[model samples]
Target: MSTVEACEAAQTCWFSCRAAALGGQTWTDGPLHWIREGAEQNLMFPTRIPADAVQSAVEEARETGVQIIGAWLGTEVDASALAAAGFERGWAPSWMAAPVADVGVSDDPRVELQEESNDYSDEYADYAEMLKLTRVRPQHTWYAAAYVEPGKAASRKLAGPRFAGRAWSHLTGETAGVFDMNVWPRFQRRGIGSGLLRAVVAAAAQAGARDAVLNATTEGRLLYETCGFRQIGAGITWWLHLEA
Candidate 1:
């Protein structure tokens, strides 16, 4: 899938060019946004950045509620400068993909991967439980904050009596997508995760998405492989915070 398309599907994530959107004229929504007030030039040329230019964009983003959130690119130019410029390593999560309906899931009978049409708040409780149960996790606190905060990916909203985590599964046209799957310790290894993944594939098939996507972890890898998912690549992120 196109990185741009993936960004739209993922919501919180953005490609390198879209990262420039973070530097718009005004900032709103919340600190979780990737925008910076005067970072357009830097966005255009992330590499070979002038010392003052990089500093200016970083400072501008901080001055407003915008957080750098990091940048994404196809090349090492940005990563190299980001590292030398003091941008810390955000994450190096494994990017995996799977062909729809290729794997067998043993958890088919227990849980049902229904389309959660309700708001994220409705799914918040389940989503939170999933996060808590997620022992093998990404290497950062930012991801933890994501589900807790609204607008960020993994966020959930209240739906009627229960909370629902929304995603491409909720959107029109796109079906094959990943979600925050959670199973309590008491319910561990019972096939909930696999079932949910199956739900994703099923949902995608219904919507026309060719495959399911996710940033998988070590623990989830086996489960995913068992279900026919393959590792697409590794997602390496570089984060820079400009100190005034």
Candidate 2:
């Protein structure tokens, strides 16, 4: 697949995985459009929509009872169409990817990465706590069994009691997409985040994935870049607040 196509496919898989884990829903309104209803009562346009069809998608998303619309800008997607439709562009993240061969695994002794089982009980609780720390109010149930680094006992209250860093990857054939990576504020810059990231990428590679992709926040762009991921495209989310 072309880099652009890979990037789009990676994002599609990432959003779908999140929706499944969180008890949300996903559907496509045709091949060019993919929508996700996140657990937080937010709508996600994870793929590109034709410029002429943007307004219709927004209208349809409103019927799902979500208060926020998160639309990602793909190649050839017109940003002005979104603005014209009452969405405000925010949090322009970078879509990045790397060949599995380029990712380096870190053997950090201070941190241990654990992949949760399918049950996801422990991982979900840890993720909930992380969301709480960030003040995110999720309205629907969400769960994922992914990579996590158990925190030290003494740091339980500040970091999650069971995890200091969390991340997950979804494999779509030969391509893998990484999602929801975060390090507790108390544990930031201690190398825990990078270690967990490397571990997850390596895990995907072991699962027969040749390429790895992720959408990175501004603060995270450098970290992924240092780990050999290059920017393939832009993932811009336009937020539209619903009227009460």
Candidate 3:
């Protein structure tokens, strides 16, 4: 195994948990990301961020000629800073899923969660899949990103090379967030959810993550609970269409 920690850092998919696989265009400033560009809308997704450091990100983007349609901040950040920079949220008020390490994972059998094997069989291909659950509707390109990020699974050289998905462990720091975990509907109820969850928990422990976080779905919440994972908070991510 390449080690889950190595995989997550190589990918920038920390807290997102592959939540929104939008084919978002991205620019990087060290670890900070400007996801989705070249449209009436672009997003500011900051990780390892300090509240006041956000506007500096906006200022940096301006130097590169990228027009920021809007920005998305986890509740821990101050949106007022973005307003000071001349942008306003175009959608409903937003919130974030809080990180909770104090909680534990559930050990239930209604589901078996495991790491995604990049194996694509017609049988597995037809499984019912739930990547991420969100309250906001997204722009077309964002939707495109979701369907594509899954293919990155093919990049792995695991035994079940046909599978495609993402996993993370927060060793030393925060773990790699589990983005989209699902069974092809044809493969559902076979403990696949639980299997994947177990794999992630093990991966996190190995990676030395302090804890893991995910923006779970209603159907998936039970799976997470069974794995000893508890909910700490919820988030609302927004997108604004601009005249690109």
Model number with the top TM-score: 2
Query: Which residue runs of candidate 1 sit more than 4 Å off their true CA positions?
Result: 1-54, 66-68, 73-77, 103-175, 184-186, 241-244
Error of 1 at 91 (Å): 2.5
TM-score of each: 0.53, 0.72, 0.43
In model 2, where is the ten-residue run with the lowest total lDDT? 133-142
| Residue 94 displacement (Å), model 3 | 12
**Which lDDT value does model 2 have at 12?**
69
Per-residue lDDT tens digits of candidate 3, residues 203-229?
Answer: 454445545555566667776776656
Q: How much is the lDDT of residue 111 in candidate 2?
A: 49
Off by over 4 Å in 2: 30-32, 38-53, 109-162
CA lDDT, every prediction?
A: 0.44, 0.63, 0.42
Q: Which ten residues in a row have the lowest lDDT in candidate 1?
A: 139-148
| lDDT score of residue 57 within candidate 1 | 56
Could you give candidate 1's per-residue lDDT for residues 1-244 as a string of tens digits? 4232342344232222123333233232221223433323123213243445445556656665454536543334445555655667665556666656574332444443322223336534443333221132321111111011123342355322222222223222342446444544544575556665665456545545565566666776887787887776655556665443
Ranking of models by TM-score: 2, 1, 3
lDDT of 2 by residue, 1-244 (tens): 2276776666665666555555667765553445554423333443444555666666766776666767666645556767888878788778888987787765765444343333236746634433321122321111222234454654655553344556766677778777777777867887677776777777667767888888888889888988889987775677788764
